[model samples]
Target: MSAPPSGPSLPKPESITASLLLGAMFNWALWGVLGCQTYLYHIYFPNDKAAFKYLIYGVFLFETAQTALNTHDTYIWFSRGFGDFLNFTKVLTSPLNTPMMGAVIALVVQLFYAHRIWTLRKSWLWFCMLLVGITLAQTGGAFYGGIRAFQAGSFVKAQTDPSNRRAVYVWLIGEAVADVLIAAAMVYLMILRRGQSHRFRSHGILARVVTITVESNCATASLAILSLIMFAGIPDTNYFTCPTIVIGKVYANTLLVSFNNRIVLRNLSQIGSPSFSSGSNIVTSSRLPLQKSTPSSAGRAFESDTITYTVHRFTETDSTTEKMDHELQETSAMKGSPSHHV
Candidate 1:
């Protein structure tokens, strides 16, 4: 009789478990850094226009929750102690709670950005609307799918029936698509602002490049996670069990941390620039005139041409100074006093 056919080998559980744990730890660290940076930016330099600190906070929170869920799932698979309970907990907490919070944060950020663009009277409102619509659709789809998976108890069944794993795949893909759209919109906005600065050109370029790179890495990591979910469909006997999921989580978290750091550094540099003081003064003066215009009808009528004049005199003696002041007044009156348009 022919020798019995050799059975397919199972992956070493210890190796896979170790990698997943390490990945989760790294992700947690990254999330902590991101959160800290957000707090710093919001507190120290609240007036920085380029800083959207909340984006980092939202992404960090979601990724941290995701890493926790994955780590728990991997632990349960290897340890086999209360595996069903842990799996159910992850399902209920991650795709439903975490993603919903992230979606809301992202929507608010997009709306704020849209308002900023509208204030500038730019023509990119339609493009922003399209991007926001797609992002909302993807987030909503993923959120609903996650809720269904939790309700159906598919996380417990993933170890047995591979067909029930479609929910995970759908969630991953939806998130990836949303991330890509957001990144694209951000990059486009940066490009639009490229030509408007001279003193801060390098900073703008670096910020835009870093933002694009981080978003691209995030999208790539999401795709990698989706690929790992596909591998989960394979039979346990023949599964190779690579560290793809852990690596994806680590990459995603790292990108978010880097993005936050860049934003903080950029804001600090802007605060130290000379233009900041001048710009603030100009803004203050502009608002003052607008506020004072409503005090009287004459003020309103003169608002368009109300000019403030200043005279400067330099002399070695008081007599010469007085003479110079008189000459300056005569010159001003002869020229009809150049008026400023408010």
Candidate 2:
């Protein structure tokens, strides 16, 4: 935690020395929080399909394993090495691999969001493909960099090498690029869809969807960019480790929040109305049931606002926009109520 150490025996840069300790601690903390979020997601959304389940659980497991590795490395450095900053054994340096694992977790989240975008806007398949490619390339570079770091005996030594810089650059830059593209694509595609139907244009549901998408990806993208800038601009100083350690949790939590918010949206759509749920299909009508109208002077307000709530049900493999639309109409017709299109 000391400033850049300067001495004949200083085997590590001051930046890396502080980063190693801080990164391990931060990763463990975030991993614990992510575990709780994952448990809640499973408990609350038990009916989610296997694909959604596997995608989330897979990322959780990966993050857990990587955190364990980081903890083990931290232990080896502090306990086995007796706080010797000069210790350069592989055990002491193994935690460098955690960034690669972080990259994997991030890529998984990106793909999940990209899939959501694909479902809503099938025309953006090419853009989603580009995101997938960038993520894969980033993971590859992260693995390559990690393996080389594994081979090197010391952390600061590897950080100082020119050959090591390329892999680091590729991984960080690729991730930063992917983060920006995914966020931009999600927001843009949602806005594009808003223009598709004049009915949907005035609906707050599209705006809500866009807001959620932006909020989720904004945190992750900001962290990615900060980490990339520090890792690339600051050189040997491991100052970037702070953001790098927590970026994975941001990705994990993004998915968790997205999943849990579905129930809230469903409830909101039915405050003064009735809705029906058949299997994975949900149909909500904005029409009120038979009741006497309240007088305007009776301290009652009658707003003609229409709220459109869309539950994409990307959790189900067979769910689609067309199917949901058809079911909405069918359900409304069954109840003899007017249908509201989302």
Candidate 3:
């Protein structure tokens, strides 16, 4: 048999391989979570808007493809290239599933949140523009870094190249910044500003939404920042790949969680209103108008006065009802109006 191929001793070979292995494992685990969330959303919100449903399924399918590619990359490294020390140094595979795919998913999620912010307040056009700009830059940096890595064809070259390293720095920093901004804007607009209004100050559904928003965005931002620190601090190994690999899944999960949360809000509303029924074609909420009747000199002419309540009907087909905050705002506006009868 021909002698096995050999090369110079690889620096931190075990560290690099271990990081890749762990990243692959974590990626698979997060994929499972994404699958479950997507399934739950499908079952719960069949009536969701076509565009909304397409976005949900699109991210999910993209994530699925990435997961498959991750598995193939892992297999190539461990199973096929077993005992090949030199494989650790090489680019080995196109990073289509890792940094590239992750960047796309992050961009999609960040932009979705940006749109949400716009829907909340049209006057915040400047804020939304800034967010979109950062998101695009982050994605551009990630793509450039991936291109540089592919051109280098080896981890050593990629790490040593100033341009490659700079691209990665830009990508990671931008990702973290974008995530933090999205989270902060959401909390401020949805909870702080909305809650300032007496109508939503003590709303239970709003509290739950705030909690989910904070948890999801914080998770992604923390991972991005951690990856940046590790990549910068430990230039000799691939430790950063661990968190970087799972970052895409976190974005996908964030989107799914946002979609699935309508179930929770719907349940909360049902509990708060006894008349609320599930799967009803026409959902109705009645608001009682404030009325003051003076006692008549003739034995209370108020006998003719009758209590009046106006019913606001929301149909399942209404696209505006897909967003909880929007629905709540509409309900509040209707409740505040005076009821006039002909």
**TM-score for each prediction?**
0.48, 0.72, 0.77
Per-residue C-alpha lDDT of model 3 across residues 138-247, encoded as one tens digit per residue = 88988999998999988778889899889888888998998888778767765555645454323555666666777888999999999999989987888888898889
> For residues 1-342, what per-residue lDDT tens digits would candidate 1 score against the true structure?
999999966455543344435544554565565566556545644443444444554555665665566556555654654434233223334334334444444444444444444443357667666656755664564466556656656433433444334544444454455456545655655566555544453444345444644465465546545544544655442121233333333444444444334333333334423332222121111212432233343222223234432222222465643543343333222111121111
lDDT of 2 by residue, 1-342 (tens): 789967764325455567768777777787888888888777766766777788779878877777777777777766787666566234343535456777878788778777776766678789889889988888888788777776765656667766666887788788778877767875676566555534422234455556776787777777777877887787656677677776777778777777655544443333333545556655554554444444445234333345333332324344453454454443221111222223
Pick out the ten consecutive residues of candidate 3 with the lowest summed lDDT: 333-342
* Lowest lDDT 10-residue stretch of candidate 2: 332-341
Full-model lDDT for every candidate: 0.44, 0.65, 0.75
CA deviation > 4 Å runs, candidate 1: 1-23, 46-121, 154-170, 190-192, 196-342
Displacement of the residue 330 alpha carbon in candidate 2, Å: 10
Give candidate 3 misplaced runs (Cα > 4 Å): 1-9, 191-202, 271-342
Q: Rank the candidates by TM-score, best first.
A: 3, 2, 1
